[model samples]
Target chain A: MKEGTSISVSKLTKRFGHFTAVDAISFDVKEGEIFGFLGANGAGKTTAMRMLCGLSMPTSGEATVAGYDLYKQSEKIKKSIGYMSQKFSLYEDLTIKENNRFYGGIYGLSDKQINEKTEFMLHHLHLEDQANTLVKELPLGWKQKLSFSVSMIHDPKIVFLDEPTGGVDPLTRREFWTMIYEAAHRGTTVFVTTHYMDEAEYCDRVSIMVDGKIEALDTPSALTRQFKVQGMADVFVQLARKAKRSDN
Target chain B: MESIQVDHVDKSFQSGKSPVEALKNITFNVKQGELFGLIGPDGAGKTTLFRILTTLMLADKGDAWVDGYHVVKDYEQIRKRVGYMPGRFSLYQDLTVEENLSFFATLFNTTLEENYELVKDIYVQIEPFKKRRAGALSGGMKQKLALSCALIHRPSVLFLDEPTTGVDAVSRQEFWQLLRGLQKQGITILVSTPYMDEASLCDRVALMQNGSIMKIDSPGGIISQFQKPLWAVQGDNMYQLMHDLRHDSRVDTCYPFGQYHHVTFNESTIDIESLKKEFQQKGVHSITIDRTEPTIEDCFMELMNQ
Candidate 1:
């Protein structure tokens, strides 16, 4: 393993009975890099992410996340990474401050640290006034931003965001990407999966999964040049159209 | 005559004690056999407008007509002539693909065989999986099935709300192709999506934000109206470059777009060579700058900021 490699996977494979979800996929994510893992709806992108995040065990693979062994150090890997899923995972019924406090406690932050961090985060997000408001009451954009902030409250080495800006408008989506850029600037490796090709273009490097394998992986420009397409969306369409998988 | 017309439409929903205006003086028209797009972010009133046009809801003020029939007065006529595929997958999940298609056909007092020609191209794609349960189908397959079911009744006008939102890239392209084929058959298509690139596929688009239409023009027309000299810049350190560009007095707007930070000057007369020299002087080395064409997304952002 190279010193600056935040994530490394070799010949990773996952099978569900007769179905192979992720088939012998290999890739490496460098420290502080924004790596886009993209695929069609059933292209095994989520399955690979779950294995790397230590939420699910890979059937067979050699991997390390945040320098911890994927199988032997799953718990340690889980602790070192922050995750924000497609669906907002925060408690909808709880107030913003309350949710932060609850998550901070779960991450094993000291009470003093939690208090200080919560205050800072609330101020940072300009949500100090809405700190007492239920998360469900917030607009979609605010909730998404708040969710991202909460994911990073523990100061994890890495953050995994799945479709973070799925339904947001272009303007709000731009604002969200700025937040991501800040996080990456702060030396946190961002591993994200998204349907938006524009978001894929923002990553430092991107890997397109097709039919349970990493079919293409490179910078957006390289991929576009290789595929002979004008943009990432076109590259995606060209690659995905050749998918032998009839499912998606 | 326009296939669909809206004149000063206004709509609001009672949220708790306050009423939220979902549409504000919205007015647009879709030409006969044209593909019209409602482009915006979530909570921008795309869905509300779609609901009203589809005759599922009523506007508080103004008027809308579908197929030359009034939205309120002739809802039955409008409903019978239009096919609506909502954002959500509303098909029977437990039923097989064939079963769902037949059920929708039966709802319109018709059979799949009777209108097979209308949905043949889309139906054929999912025909191999006709026996598969709708819930078991993949996202793309489900999208195809939903589209097929929508057209099973042979409605002259089609209304699709974010039809390709969650589907994969290839499937989205295929879906749009199906729409084009339907258009060739003279079906007026009205679609809504948050994706800006998809706006280019439409004959004309209404850029909506905060329940109001900001601009209604062809995608090319909208881009042409972006009267700023835009440049895409990339350097060794993107975050620092973004921060520096935003703080620069000459730089009007600087946002990270893909691999480059898309920057527009505050003044049109600013030269790109000087801008590169300024960045180099700021201790940023290896900076590349290119004058880029504005996209629909660029125009949308500029309009929203204004």
Candidate 2:
């Protein structure tokens, strides 16, 4: 563990049966830094993220998340970090207020704190009028925005977002990134994965995974300069095109 | 002759107590062999429209035709000629890739050998694992299998709904190239996507919002119609810079673009250097501003604001 380092991984790897999903990879994320985890389909990004979030065990490597050891304190790591993915986050059947309160309770917040936080979050999102509205009834953008807000109800040290802005409108997508920026500004380290190359530019540093290995890692500008490419999209295509594990 | 014709189509769904309008007076046409795109986000009625045209669902009002056959009356004809790749992978997961393709071919009374050339380019990519179950395949491979199944019958019209929604940039580009190849083969393709960048790939795109068509034009035509002076601004502190720009009188609209904040001004003559200086004076330093082209995303946001 190092001072001001929110996450540190040294040769972290995950293997399944005969296949090495995530080969030995190493990276460090500073506190409050927005780290972009990028990869093509079946490039082992999910496998690696699962290990860091304590949802899956790493086969071999040393890592620390939110000041907790990756192996010994996985439960503690789970408590100190938040996660939201596009595929699943909030329960669609639950009302907006209920979803917020439920997540707050799951994080072990007191009843009084839950109520207060729920009100503050609703007010910030301008959803006070729709507090009792079921999440399924909300628009796609509103649902995603509310999902992110609920994930932060407990104020974890680091938040993991997996394709958080997928399918949202262009404007709403930017608004979602603004929320991410605000969260990082408040000292919450953001570990995010997105398919959108433009979003990669917003990250302080990005690591691109190819064939279970981190083939490129640097600031966006540095990466563009190093690859001699016009943008992150071009850089991504060039690197991801060489991947051998397209079959998953 | 038009490959597809949608006339004043309307559809709605019953949700709880009220009826939600999924499509309201939607009308559009795709010409023969033209690569038309339905550009929209989720719940924009793209899937609803696709269903109506594919003869899987009927509209409450108006009529549509595919390959000169009525969507409702000649649904059998429409179904025979149209190929649909749904947003979700709706294939037999338990079936192997080869099995799925062969099953679809059997359904259309055709053999794999008969239509091999149609899907060869895409099929060969996944052919190595022809024995692999569809469920075990990755996202990209699954999509290819689905497309192969959709094209198994060698239909005249292809309807792809958000085929590139969650796909990566590289795979998405590959998919579009495949669509272009299909178009060159004289197959009229209708595809929908949430990514604004993909709009440029379509010969023409219809921007849909809230169950209504916002605009329909070529990507270049749409961008040319952007009636604003757009500028790309980059500052050291983007969060603060955005806040300051939004409140400033000079900035009419501001949105975060890649590596820069795209700010638009009402004054067409708003000089870039002067705008940069004004922001620098407001304690926003390390500023760089340049005149930039309005992308489909900018045009989309502009249309949304209106």
Candidate 3:
């Protein structure tokens, strides 16, 4: 174990009946690094992520997330990491302040701590005036930002975001990435999955998964140079062309 | 001749106490065999305009015509001459792939064999799984099946709304290839997507936002009109770089773009050598700057902010 390793996995495998969804994947994420996970749909990216997040049991592997064993200490793992899925999981009917309080309580924050943190969060996001506004009444970009803030309310060491900027306009997408950069600057590790090739370029390192295996992993510039491609999109197309999965 | 035309069209829907204007004075023309794109984000009126052109909805004012037939007065003729694939997967869930294709063909008074040539390229990919229920198909397969069903009737015009929204990168590339093949067969394609990169694939595009057309031009032409020298700048600290660039009086606009910050000058001329020196004086280190070509996304964002 290294001093600042956030996640470490070796020969991790998962199977559903006879189908091997994730096959002997191995990787490590350093503390505060932005890791981008790229793959075509149905290419086992979700299965691998599920296992790493402690949401599902790996068929076989040696792994540690947030300095806890994946199998024996999943509950402890859950507490040390924050997750925001593609689907908006926050309560829409609740006000921004109420939603923050609810998530803070779920993370086992003391009442005094929750109050202080909630006040700081509202002020930080410039949502103090709209703290009483229902989440549904906000625009899509605001709602997405609020959801991200809620995920970080407990101040977990690591955050997993799945397609965080899907369907947003380019301007809003830029704004969202700025927020992500701030989190990484604050020493919070970020693991994100996205289909947008442009977003891949922003990560410190990226891994392209194909057919339940990691086909290529490197910095965006290195991957492009190694593949003799012009950009991350071309690198993705080149790798995806080699995929054996016909379903996606 | 123009295959489709919209002139001063307007549409709105009542929500709560106020009516939300979905389309506002929209006007455009699609030439025969042209691949035209409607590019915008969600709630930008692309779907509403598509519905009006397909004879599925009526405009509050002005007019639209498809295949030389008025959308309102001759909707039956227009519908018969156009193929529409909606944003959502709209095929029968329980029905198999083969069943869906044949059913749509029947509605147009045609047989699968009669128009199989039109959809053969797309259909063959999913033909092996013809017995699989449409709902059971994966996202990419479902997309292929929906496209095949739309083309089974061999309509002169095809309207696809955000067909590749949730599909993967590879499938999205394949879908575009399929559209190119269809265009070669003399079919005019009107497709909508929120992805700005896809706009370049079309012969012409309309950048829409807030129920209005911001600009209408060929993708290349729009990029040419950017009219400012753009530079991609990066430093050791990206977050700090963005903040400093935004505050600089010489910078007109600065936004984070991938690994670097994209900046345009407020003035017509920029002294790159001086700017580099200026950054060093401000305590920023390892600064790299390069002139870069503007893309359709750049044009869209510029117009949107205006």
- Total clashing pairs for each candidate: 0, 0, 0
lDDT of 1 by residue, B1-306 (tens): 699999999999987446889999998899999999999888899999989999999899999999999999999998889999999889999999989988998889999999888888888888998998999998778888888888888898999999988667777777788889999999999999988888999999999898999999999899989978889899877777888999999888987777788889878787778888888888787899988998888888899899
Per-residue C-alpha lDDT of model 2 across residues A107-145, encoded as one tens digit per residue: 899999999999999999999999999888888899999
TM-score versus the correct structure, for each prediction: 0.96, 0.98, 0.96
Those runs of model 3 whose alpha carbons end farther than 4 Å from true positions after fitting are: B16-18, B281-284
Which number leads on DockQ?
2
- The best-first sequence of candidates by DockQ reads 2, 1, 3
**Alpha-carbon DockQ of candidate 1:** 0.68
Candidate 1 lDDT for residue B116:
86
Q: Say which prediction, candidate 1 or candidate 2, comes out ahead on DockQ.
A: 2
lDDT of 2: 0.91
Docking class for model 1 is: medium
**Candidate 2 at residue A124, lDDT?**
92
Q: What does DockQ give for each predicted structure? A: 0.68, 0.81, 0.63
Give the best candidate by TM-score. 2
lDDT string for model 1 (A72-133, tens) is 99999989999999787899989998998999999999989988998998899888898889
RMSD of 1: 1.8
Ranking by TM-score: 2, 1, 3
